[model samples]
Target chain A: MKKYNNIADKLVKSSIANPERIYNYLLYISAAFFSVLIIFPFYFLFVVSITPQHGLAEVRYLPTGFQWENYIDTLEIVPLHQYILNSIIIATITTVFVLIVASLAGYVFGRFKFKGRGVLLVAFLIITYFPGTTYIIPLFRLFTGNISLFGLATPDLYGTPWPVVLPLAGITLPLATFILTVFYSRIPDGLEDAARIEGCTRIGALFRVIVPLSAPAVATVGILTFILVYNEFFFSFLLTDSSYNNWAPLVHGIQMYEVTTVRGSPYHLMAAGSILGLIPVTVLVFLGQKKIVSGLTAGALKE
Target chain B: MGDVILENIVKQYEDVTAVENINLNIKDGEFICLVGPSGCGKSTTLETIAGLTKPTSGEITVADREVTYLPPKDRQIAMVFQNIALFPHMNVHDNISFGLRLRNFDSKEVKKRVENAAEILQIKEILDRMPDELSGGQQQRVAIGRAIVRDPEVFLMDEPLANLDAKLRVHMRTELQRLHKELGTTIIYVTHDQAEAMTMADRIAVLNKGELQQIAPPLKCYNEPANQFVASFIGSPSMNFIEGKIRSGGFESTHINVDINIGNYDDLSIGDPITLGVRPEDVYPKSNSPEIQSQSDPIDAQVDVLEPMGDEIFVYLRLNVGAEDGPTVTETSSADQLLMSVDPDSDVSTKDNIELVIDREKLHLFESGNGNAITHGIGEQTALNQNR
Candidate 1:
């Protein structure tokens, strides 16, 4: 035991003397480990996506043979293009709606001093804490026109794109508003004052100075909202019918593969559909990776 | 044409009064510096004049036009802030011409004016560089350039050089003085640094605790401070204040006594509390008393500390006259210490017992109750009494 203690002390001292080199080696090893951990599932999904359905039992680390027709089969089995189009439209509309409303709400809550501002901000925060399932029944009733507001009948938007777009935008707004509020508030007040002194109105300063400086946060909110609405399953599945024309999103379309297959579950086709669905989100994240990182980390440290 | 006037300006926020009943009448092309310690309402006073902050009740006029309620842009004024609030997204040219472009000036005219401002500031070469790429001094110059291109009647600056390095601050002081000379605009500068005000301002308006103390030339403020606050605040080492009371014979305090004649002023009565203020330079060793024409009697002191600068040495002297028996001397109280500035070459060291005398011609007396000036140059008052 005494001899072991001496060796451990020598090892500790050596590492401490050249800590940076050891630290770098440990950093790279752990980073590479995490990279593999994150990438392995996606890699497996892609390998399974192109493997033939009959070869699944024999499949190990690699696919036995390429079955490129699985992608074609996945598209033909369901109206995947129509679902993709529907998802695109819904995500775009939801993202735009959330951005516009959140930016305004964020600017007001962040900059202006008014009565009940704290209460209102806390109320928005509370809305974010409640899960979507908790409010789905009431939202379904409201959209189907069963729940009237102020003695006026709510519009029947059950099977249309509005049902999915509006609620998703509403669901995403609080978090987006939170990000924007924190980002906008961190900007020096002097910039707005300078703008006003230079002949800009309050709103002009918002667009010209505040909004331009907040591009990273805005892109962050946009990408998150787009990906969320694109892949939303429960709400879109419940709100809209299974008809592709009725604006069922890609997630709903992917779920269709489980039931509509004639034989035992065609897992390859499902994998192909899921892989194809990830393209848009993948491209968006790649494009806005820097912005999202900055947006999340901004205001965490003081200038 | 750009005379600025602020009448009865008062600003109160909830419980605190930022500035109260402030009035200033600035002449055209005058460089006036509003200077004070932090939270002294100097910046608040300047903001009210610039129309950035509305005074609770006051009237302001710029260029002979009443602009009390007008917005800052409509008041024909441009302000430079302490943080150098240049839009970080814009390059130097765009930042300087932001106001011009907002007003929808012809593109050609805006270009010409930006170029002219750049030339005036001598930053013409870096017009295309971003704000973060510029050094601190360059960023401040860009801020000033932004103000100058507006061609407003009054230019308000709020501690624009407070962020620069000490050497750069000194350099910008001369540059700002030159700018004031060339522009001839009614520039109202605000800073907490008295040295900056003393060097650049034609008139320095000293404020303390939301009240304007005095507005006078730099030398007048130094030589004849309007009150004790003005006296202590305007000078670098600060004027030494010795609290005492007026007796029938003269002024009496714990450490020393001075014979001041009360017959010269009707307001002063026997037993009235007074404060004696004398600058560090007015204090001298007893050996130089023969060269001084009107000097006070020697006061015994022991040197506490010595700080020798290139030109002079600041000798902190602990008055030994009353410290052993006086009730005011405590471990923390600085009231018993006097700061004296002697010639740098003078052989003064710590802990040396010495006798010092103040120049009577530069002595200032203030009423302790209201901190108002009672008299300057007590020697002249005594001389007048003797002549009579």
Candidate 2:
């Protein structure tokens, strides 16, 4: 019994001396807790997506039956593939557009000093504070040719993807600009000056030195804008008609499954459609995961 | 073939002048150093010469071509920054060859130049390594290699070794001097360290408050400073200054009980206020040094502090210290204190009373009104004296 107590005391003393053991256990526990908190909803979504239509209301953690046909049925009931393609096109266009415009604006805002620079930057910040709904009605009227600018009739864009794409791009632009500006400003001025002295033009320096150094930041902004536009529901719902031909996005296609079926509302089909809609963004975030994490942490730390 | 001349360069930044009416005639193959304290516009002057910053009014000619309004790329010059701005995304070879590649040099020429620069800077082993993978000294060598590969007519370095440790800094100083000898390019170096300027420069331009104080060879600036500022700025442990008036016989101070016969100054009138300047090494213990001719009259002082610096001992002596109730030394003031350097082997301790004499042959006199030098080596009657 004395030897056993000595062994116990040694274990306690060693653990006390190295608090990393306790901290490691605490870290694992908290990490597992948060992981469950974050991933349970996706797990539930998957379970419901594979559940039969009649079994969704049952009180169960697991699916009652595996119905892989729900995905096919969701596709048949609503044109989800066409909507996904449309979302791909719109999100790509908006990401490219925002990346180009935001990087240039960020470069200007980050590097140059001029009159009213602060005021203009604050103006961009202020634009981010307003909800998208505040401008949705006017934007809808504008896209429908009811609202005109400078006595000219606005182009009718209600049935097309422009209405959704333009508003989403406009709404996401300021935040992307802010991220890129903060990132670009953190790059030392010496690099640009060195490039200029090394026979590069100002724009040449931007492309060769600044852009390559800003790859992680550009990826951060690109992934963020792409995901935001891809998963957007409000603009897609209000901007286009209820037809896949009108280039309605995946979110709108999923929302169409709320119609009453023979059993009840087809929420399982909606869950299946939602899971299908998550593929592109999931792949994107996975591929650029390293850059996104580093970019965010780099922005947080003061040089 | 790279000789740079700056004609009346002035840079005004709205409310402040960074550098004013600066003129420099840097010769071909000259290693000129712009040395001054921080905010002294030394870097501004270098920038104007490199065409990085345009002068408000000036003409900068490099290799006999006027490049006043031209961009940095068109100026036929390359620069090394104090931060050692190696392109972080590129390896050493790519960084060194950035200029050559930008000018659309063929792959063969670019590789040859990059390899040549790597060999010159002794950074050939780091050619495949990224900047972050190298140490600070290696990064600085890569930056220098970048400048060298450009083969521009002129090279500008802005305190390139400032970020290195002391030993590395000293090592790079010798390396840079070797590079200058090998390339024979007109190199303009800017640093706030007087030692770096004195050791590496063919000519040193000292600036203060946006104005050029003196531009001369290093030893000339040391032995004969143009003004009181240069006298104080150039030397280590700086020159000691005493505010006094020139009497009929010599110089006398009001705060301290000290008098020195600075000979007859033709430029100075009787009863005129002048400042006497002497370096720490010029002050000798009177009894020990009998070889110092033309010495001032001995003044009684008490040693306050002794700092042994391995090779030499810096003795801080307090003047007017006979009575116990005499003025005590204050941390904020150094008016009544004189610093003297003695040989390391000499025996000296704090609180010991000693007699100190200034070497009259190395004494400097300046006008108290304008802080301009009146004369250096003021003990001899035949010494050159100028009134300005």
Return the top candidate by DockQ.
2
| Model 1 spans > 4 angstroms off | A1-37, A51-61, A70-79, A108-120, A255-269, A290-303, B49-75, B254-257, B284-306, B315-337, B342-358, B379-388
Consecutive 10-residue window with the lowest summed lDDT within model 1 chain B: B323-332
Tens-place lDDT digits, model 1, residues B30-115: 99999999999998888887777889988899999999888777888899989888887788999999999999999999999999
Consecutive 10-residue window with the lowest summed lDDT within model 1 chain A: A293-302
Model number with the top lDDT: 1
lDDT of model 1 at position B310: 88
What interface RMSD does every candidate have? 5.0, 5.0
Candidate 2 root-mean-square deviation in Å: 5.5
B1-388 in candidate 2: lDDT tens per residue? 7999999999999899999899999999999999999999999999998777899998899999999999999999999999888887778788888889889999999988888888888888879987877888888888898898878899999998888899999999999999999999999999999999999999999999889999999999999999999999999999999988887566788444234343544777778888889999999988887898767767888888899999999999888675568657563257678999999998888888888888878988899998999988855322222110
Q: Model 1: per-residue lDDT, tens digit, A103-149?
A: 89999988988899889888987887888899989999999999878
Query: At residue A136, what lDDT does model 1 achieve?
Result: 89
Q: Where is model 2 more than 4 Å wrong at Cα? A: A1-37, A51-60, A72-79, A111-119, A146-151, A200-216, A242-245, A255-269, A293-303, B51-56, B254-266, B285-310, B318-335, B344-358, B379-388
